[model samples]
Target: MSTEVKLSQSTAIRLEQARTKGMSDADILKAIQANDVAAFDAVSEEDYRYDEFLSYAADHGENLEVAVQDGYRITFNTRGGLGIYLEKAFGVVAEKDFAVGEGIITGLKLKPEQAEVLAERLASNWVITESKDVPEGKVLTLKLRALV
Candidate 1:
């Protein structure tokens, strides 16, 4: 088998151990799948853009996803916790988040034009996540439920 698959298998085994240790179904899955939705702390925080995005959402708000950012709209479901993670590990797929910012502006009581401008700018920055200063050991983090 390929190295990637072998690594995945190893990770899955570790996750299974955790699952047997009385961890939540979600946490176990998050550890196993290691895919987009399962992008949690540690190694995941290192590479995944969505990992950083999810962390940002906790401080700013909840419900982070793909497509929309800054103020939430249509986006991916990277925030679904362990359910998404488990499905991915088993090779099962899930629906992505899809709520356009159509009425979000009015919903948030901001002017539509103003919201549009903000969205445009935020989307621009999303491509280039402003890196944070990482310490020696801690590094940056993903703020996954498993960690907290």
Candidate 2:
């Protein structure tokens, strides 16, 4: 008995392009097997481009995380908390506002002295948590919690 893996149209096009560049079928299959899907034993309908997101973040030297509390209320948490903080503290305007109940912004370029001030200012109805020296001092992940 044998099984077949159905490649998406994009993946098929990529395979053909690789073939035109003189790559052997074995090598192309190996590359496809390595990247076209995750290692789980399940079929995927579309590519999520997780690799692309991570690669871009790495190239730009950014470590960001977002968390939304369960059953968060827009009326209580408000929608523009993080945006307000970003604009006031760092003189940076958020490209978009966070969804209600999704009130945590984790990546910011902050100096050690500035972290305390940021926490204090956002403390009104919001909780501020800091993580430092993750793997090294080069990266920081801030976890902000909002009361809803």
Top model by TM-score, which number? 2
Q: What is the lDDT of residue 133 in candidate 1?
A: 34
Stretches of candidate 2 above 4 Å error?
1-79, 93-101, 133-148
Model 1 clashing residue pairs (backbone): 26-82, 66-75, 66-76, 74-99
Q: What is the lDDT of residue 87 in candidate 2?
A: 45
> For candidate 2, lDDT tens digit of each residue in 40-98?
11222243223343233335432211101111111122335444434443444454321
Cα RMSD for candidate 2?
19.2
Q: Using lDDT as the measure, which candidate wins?
A: 2
Give the TM-score of each candidate.
0.18, 0.32
Off by over 4 Å in 1: 1-54, 63-148
Query: Per-residue CA lDDT of candidate 1, range 1-148, in tens?
Result: 0111111222332333333345455553443334343433333322232333333444543322221122222222233422233232322233322112211111112233433432332211122112233232111112222323
